[model samples]
Target: MTDAGVIDDYVTGLRRVLRGPRGPKIDLVAEARDSLLDAAEALEHGGLDRAGAERAAVEGFGSIGEVAPDYQETLSVPAGRRPAALLFVSVPLTTLLWSLIWRVFPTGPAAHAAWPGWFVPVARGLDILQMLVGVIGGVALLVLGRGLRRIRRPGTG
Candidate 1:
């Protein structure tokens, strides 16, 4: 793996992963490339074997997962269920809203009566299922949010 081509391949892979959504916020793509190249140059300058230095360089870069948290703060991810709450609130509300709008502003009364005859039972069933899912998911998120808050509380440790 002392070959420049081998080193470049490793660097390219690292770059792609580092640029991915879950990757480190630090400029890891450039950093990995530069670090590998520097390692190669250092190996040559010190008269050390290329193969050993290449191995060392790869090892020193560390696993990508291990590198994520180091830069997580830069991403400013919120510490709770803000996203979850937003989703839970929006979904059922949107469904119910659309249902009401369709009922109240039907193009015609005959259409409205026909709609309930054909679709009310189905819609009611869906509403029940939606309620069950929303309750379960919301409760889970609430519990998780509370746990996170407790863990972050001062003097809790």
Candidate 2:
């Protein structure tokens, strides 16, 4: 059987103060619980009763106030990276790919003379749409990052 209250209380309090993405928070909380339980078991093996060992284990864990900033820093890293994927890498790389393709086989006077009537307008429309979507998506991500920052607890990001 598990030693209940002391460990439960410590984990609950730790969960309360931590602010981050859901997946990381769950992993960190579960990790903390496992470590506490293992330490408690080791203490009990040294002749302390389960309750006494659990209480002591909790005490050994620093106060939530003292540890939360560290946890917040861990959470912030992934939060910061989410935008860089699209904004820094995918967007620029995709734009460069398209530019190179057009440069190698550009639609100039000779190419346009051979092209069907429908191709020009269709290609032009798609170009406009691509630019519009890129601008809209970039703005949305920036706004979303700002919104996430606003909602997060101070110093949590």
Best by lDDT: 2
- Please state the error at residue 114 of candidate 2 in Å: 18
- Of candidate 1, the 10-residue stretch with the lowest lDDT total is 148-157
Q: How does residue 47 of candidate 2 score in lDDT?
A: 97
lDDT scores of the candidates, listed in order = 0.57, 0.74
Model 2 lDDT tens row, 3-56 = 568998988888888766888888888988999899899999999999999998
Model 2 quality (TM-score): 0.59
The numbered model that scores best in TM-score is 2
